[model samples]
Target: MTDRPDVLVVGAGPAGLTTALQACAHGASVRIVERRREPFRPSRAMIVHPRTLESLRPLGVVERLLRRGDPSPSARLHLGRRVVSTTLADVALRDTAFPHLTLLRQADVEQVLAEALEERGVPVERGVAAVGLAQDRAEATVTLRRDDGGAEPVSCGAVAGCDGQDSTVRRATGIDWRGRAYREEVVLADLDLDSDLDAGVLHVAAGRDGLVFLFALGEGAPWRLLATRPSRGGDAPFGQPGQPVPRPELRELLDVAGFDVAVGRVAWSARVRLQHRLAAAFRHGRVFLVGDAAHTHSPAAAQGMNTGILDAVNLGWKLPFAAHADEPDTMLDSYERERRPVARQVLALTHLVFFAEAAGHPAPAFLRGTVAPLLAPVVPSLTRPTLLAPVVRLLSQGWVRYRGSALSSERWAGGPGPRAGDRLPDETVTCDGMRTRLHRLTARPGVHVLLARDAEEVGASVVEDCPVSVHRLTSRPGRRMVAVRPDGHVGFRGTAVADLTAWLRLVGARARSADTATQPADTATQPADTATQAADTAET
Candidate 1:
């Protein structure tokens, strides 16, 4: 019914909405199309990991998410009659300001995000679905069909497919879905129970029948459920709510698990299998895919939504550059390279979860009984509250830093630099004596100015000609003068003003000039062998 926008998002879930918000925040126009008439009625995703909460900092949603969710301090695994392993969430991520996991319904979180998007002036368009997509070198033409059978075409500079598992965009682009599917069927229900279940722990029980996972939803509420079928699938469990429950089925599960129930109401129930899949590439020309469309893994670690939200955070900054800025085409490719490896690692973790009950493997049993519990005491020493933490930082904050493509040449130019796979910390800086978080300062899609004590060594003569801004590093300057990218990375390093100018010009190329044939590399030469070099390499 209307013309195209700067970008077209094919889903309105967390990933899609977050991508739209991030892109628009950087001044790019966007439109979102969703097949669903409305957001899901009840909450689905119940766990938001600490890493995800940290990622939400830049988006300004963590405080809100924490308010609406319950903090899960720990998790315990039971083997038959014994508590085999227990990992403290707080201790596991001890080095972070947000060290504890939050348990909130996906529905609630999605609703908050949707409302936030609208508040920021970008609303989700319900009752429309992407039926087809056509892309050229410059843009993606997305075709959407309305609920009433009307059709409209949108031509966007870029497209992000966050349309869940059965994504039409992924199929429309002919991208291969490469991953395994979980055969297990899980039955979930939200209920007001009668027992005194602790709100701080996620309890799991492994039995001959199947496994059951229980956690507190919030004040006076709890989520009780069982893996209806074997993780790999064989037979469905007893007590199918919509069907029938043997007299002993419900009572036995509750009695053993200590579910203090008093004839409560069942909010909703469903049977679904887990899936692990990823697109061959996140970007196909001008059409890019994110969240479930790009990667799907088992829900064991409860990382599906977390990873999806993170996908939004990752691509959120990149899409605007690819769609509106004069950035290089090679920069877009970095999305696939950086995120794919992460998805693969996430899948591997989910796979490790499957081994918890390997029938013939005694090693798994031993690990379940020993190594896991030991992790509790040692978790703290391994972590630190650094800027840009790692995925492994979940074990401890020390794993966080700006080490990969996430860094900018400015930071890599020998000033203070952020390591890849690390968390970006929001330090308070006084601009005109107005204090604000570093997160807010770098929000714009361009180079960041980080001035440090060592920056003077790089020599202002080399960077003075740069187009980016400069800030001097003072006491406790996170690092020396580092120029960060629009995606919250260091692009150039050193206090030298000339080097800053050159790096900015090198990275500020337009989308139209992204092709090698159009814009050749500048004489500035790439940042070599460091985080800045990697980030520049990511862009090239």
Candidate 2:
């Protein structure tokens, strides 16, 4: 395969593509082979979370996504005729620069990623299936079969599997997949619909027939309908592949949900069972796994693709460095440790939502009639934020951080009280007189700046004295500046430059003396200037 590409990636999906792109960005040569001879046919995961947006931004495609996708205003939960709870998209995510979720086809997101990857000079190779892998400490040899019955072996220092849940990579490595299979299956469809509903709203209703969820696809496309299983036992959770649900059958189902059909074409439909699973380990010798290759969970929170893409991003930058680095080789372990807990959290939360709906919660009808209207005003609070700091902290994507990571050390001074796994907060900021998201300011594949009130004293001499563009932040500036990692964790706090010297040693970057950093002589602050060589660590 072209004289042995540097990295052999099996699969061209979001996970694999992201891995390839990230690896390329780090200056590693890569070869990605896919069985599917074409791009995705339709939008699968239609919702892009803010964290995913952040990941895409560094690749220079976020604005394109925003321009092409529909901006969903909020997430609403309703009972038959009343609304039980409503989370305004804007308010719920006010903590994130991208406060709202964008509704777009998964294919759309892939297209953007694909273009960006090509522009970066690493295009994916399609129509070739990776059938086997053989890896040694020195290199990983990948076997590929072309559509024309040709075979080839490509060698690389490392191999990353970004394949889906039933990933061949997981099987090839022989890692035990551990998790429970959900009992319920869901029938989902994306299609055109005639509606008077607002384009930015996600409507969820409980009907006498079952539970129904409708999300506006865009201005004129089809709406995504997720209906609960009917009592007749005909509508199982996961639909069979050969037997298709006819238009009339789908119409009847909609009618039972109290929605009047306006006669539109169905774009896509499928039945999928909910699964919560994870690999026992994400790393094995020279082989590693990211995205769905490592974990799978229910889609209640719409976090699967988003989380997987992030997995690609997080592992992407690290792999190149680790592949070339020497010694302990402990850096890769952090991937599993940091991500496993996140998977568990996603599984739990998604299961919670599914359980609530399955139990009929406060009953769908009750929610639609009585709860929805009452909660609509608060919907903004529930939906919009710079990142889904609360829910995502578990998944470690959005504002999530890992203070106790391999890269972080507790010995650093003036460290915040946040723990190893906490989501960093977002602050409004103005750089160059152009007000922009704090997240937007952080250069890709690098650290973010969290300028604390004491940042001038503690950070000035360390980061400020360096060539890196560290945003100056205060606890209560017109906005806050929290230094986030490439993976979006708080790497350093600029609150107190008094701790500058200690932090520099921990970050492993060479820096000038701390003489440039001076807390006012009259300033009465504790001697946070503790002498320690540990790196600065923080919560997500």
Candidate 3:
């Protein structure tokens, strides 16, 4: 690295790549580093929810992923040979353009994001790992260690710890990683199966040990198998990493689970170690954690990479703005405010979801075998597409509300539509003389101000040292106005001009009376509302 960049991302996985891509998209100089010389091309995480796709749209990676990923797929739940199926289409949300669930390998996601970053002239330095970190009031310095015994110091305005479970950046912060690893090991393999099973359906069967999962979602392989290897000394000889997982051993587990599908070829196989962990603090001084560096959970809910990507999204928009603020520390604290709680909630949510599938083989022998057969007919209904709608919605994360956040302010806060701290769903609108979705207006970086056609007269007064894009609503009629944050959440919503200005000012937004903005807004004629506005918003 030469001159200091705005951000230094220390991992090239989904989280690190997304952090670099998004920070670059928002006009920040970002340098990303990866310890591994060769990319982890394995199909580790094979699921991408719709909300994650919506969040990545601004970075121009979602469409590429959709082109190469499977959009609609059915899942088959096998309980003692009685199979019940469900399709993602049945649980699709009508409001979002990307409603259906998508299946894409984690490797593909990293590739698309890395390519996008390369297009923006941000190169990912491979074979370079951040071994040491030190930060003061000015900037953060990181020690980079290469594979060939080369070491150098790289400086950056801030360091994003996209590094995984063993994060050196996290260690530098002295934040305790509070988590535990599962006793049972998981064997991950991409297998070619010889069976009549639908190629587009995901298969999972309950066994005396744990759930046996077979996925047919990858672009190349037709099936990827995830099965639990009972604690050491079990009949299944799926040993520790680097130990060979024989095809007969895999067959032995499948036979006990009643899956008669023949394993044709073991294209790729690895013994996976499962762990659950979350960082004590997501931010420490100039060092911030993202992805597995911040939190790691079981892949049962497909939340591992998606949650990391969400972590990156929440931190990406704020890191770029921190480079310009006078009070960078105070400016960055809100990132934890808005996101830390969400991570905590996810940690708890995924913990339960992970065990719901009996992962790690924790269930008793009777429940795994005898009880499953007895309840086969009734238990399968739990996976019915209609009933899974709420589960799907929860997994989509579109319903996540940040109403308690300081960035969210409500005036008498009662309304039928979205309030401050709520997600801003896409709506039809025209831009540049062409009809487009509302979310498209944010293809560029900065805060987006959505104003009713009638409110244009008052919208100009809303200015910020930070780049702000203001759009006048012409497709509909109303006096309501809303401010959409860079992370796609509503910061403020109201109809009064004075109230909106007060919010802008509260959020460190500058007021304009002349060619340039005045720091202390001339509030001589401005009338402030008691409830419509309160607290601060994003800083420049």
Candidate 4:
């Protein structure tokens, strides 16, 4: 190992591991350290959204994750006496390669990422904790405390704080964490149920009391249960945090959830006190917070772990590029600008969903018991694959865009494809005389230029300018040239080869000129919601 790694990741969760993986893949020397001695731990997150799978695909671990997780399962929603069956399987997710949610344990995800790191020769230094940090103009010095009561300071070009809510790296930076805890506590468990519930179907019920979900995720246990237990004001008697849930309590919960199921055994259970919070800042000089250290919210839409993974992916590829950037901090600033707003949006969405579904107020109760039952009949029509396209696009986080960030500068007219800052949506194309998907080109390490026609015009100068690669698509022939970033985002799109050269140079690429040309940015950028536009015409 080198004395000073280009990047130092301070935790070993999905975010930290991903940061290490992506940074290393992009030619950055990396060292990942975790406080937990054990390589793996049980995780609260179980569902990996489609967008997350897309982000993880380039890392070469999605197949491993799919092997351990369940995908495209049907769902049976029970609203009072009405049972509305729907299929989450193959619901209008044509824009993505993995169109369904992957229900796997968080431990399984971390294990896969950790093993991927090991294969890359960057093992996680367990039992080492980042206790102190100091950054100068040159590099950051992190004081680490090992398990054997030894302490030392290591220097690095940048630091990634992917630790969870109570993150030492976040605390070391003294960033203000602002948010509140919900009075409600949710009891989540993996159990063996002696009931006729279909093992391949997810069951959800919302009564006047609250909402409960049961899924056959097969992570440790065959059945996973999430029941909302609203707080009864002050000093309310409830079972302990990690205690075994008794049979009577299970019966009461099942009755409240309108499920006629008998619990055979509880494989594992925990009473989770939900909280909502966001760091006032995601970056403190060279110390950047990620994952739960940056944001936390209820698992209403399952954004917790997925959001952190995206955070790591968004920042990972940028760290190496920023090191040689003309304005290094300017490049890094986009991390906070692009991510903080996403956290705010998630907090608001989860808060609204939590309040509507589980709040103690009678208004929400009326909505659940009376309003929901009346609307149950229309649920099937709403969940139809064609009708469900919008919801899938939104919840899968396929709609997230960085169009407003400093990095995304659109240079062409509203194209028939994704705009700058939007993810380079996966599409079928002819690459190297072989039928393959578009991601096969962008998945490799470096900036990829997709040329629909002329391959000779790109020249060797562009590739030599930076970590750039050129590909001439034998399909999707048009007057289009799109430059995909390392993180699978469309950094530039235009009709002119000269303009593509200018983009490479503007983004810290010292383009040695075969065609020294410059063009003004397409200032008339598309509207804020690029995903909606892409979904409408993504197939083109």
The best candidate in terms of TM-score:
4
What TM-score does model 2 achieve against the real structure? 0.76
| lDDT to native, each model | 0.58, 0.59, 0.71, 0.77
| Cα lDDT for residue 105, candidate 3 | 83
Residues 391-486, model 1: lDDT tens digits = 445422223233555323433433343532344554544433344335444433334455554444323222221123344434444434555554
lDDT of 2 by residue, 1-540 (tens): 246666778877778888887777655677777787887554446677767765655555666677677664565555444454434345354545565556777777777778877886777788888788888877788787898999987788778888677777789889998887666556667667776755567777655334677877632345777765522333333212223456776677676666655648776675665567878888887788887778877666677788888778777756655543333265567677677777667767777776655434447546544555566666556543433446543332554557667655333345544432345444454443433444444534444444544435223333321222344443334222243445555555433443433444444322323242222211111112111001001101
In candidate 4, what are the lDDT values of residues 198-302, reduced to their tens digit?
887889998888888898764557888888877433332222235445667766888888898888777777666677899999988888999889998887878
Clashes of each: 64, 82, 1, 0
Ten contiguous residues minimizing lDDT sum, candidate 2:
531-540
- List the pairs of residues colliding in candidate 4: none
Candidate 2, residue 64: how far the Cα is off, in Å? 1.3
Off by over 4 Å in 1: 72-89, 92-96, 199-201, 208-210, 218-222, 226-228, 231-264, 323-327, 357-392, 395-447, 453-471, 476-479, 486-488, 506-540
TM-score leaderboard ranking: 4, 3, 2, 1
Candidate 3, poorest ten consecutive residues by summed lDDT: 531-540
Error of 4 at 243 (Å): 6.4
Question: What lDDT is obtained when candidate 4 is compared to the true structure?
Answer: 0.77
Clashes of 4: 0
Query: If scored against the real structure, what TM-score would every candidate get?
Result: 0.75, 0.76, 0.85, 0.88
Off by over 4 Å in 2: 72-78, 83-89, 92-95, 191-201, 208-210, 216-221, 230-243, 262-264, 324-328, 359-399, 413-424, 428-437, 448-484, 492-540
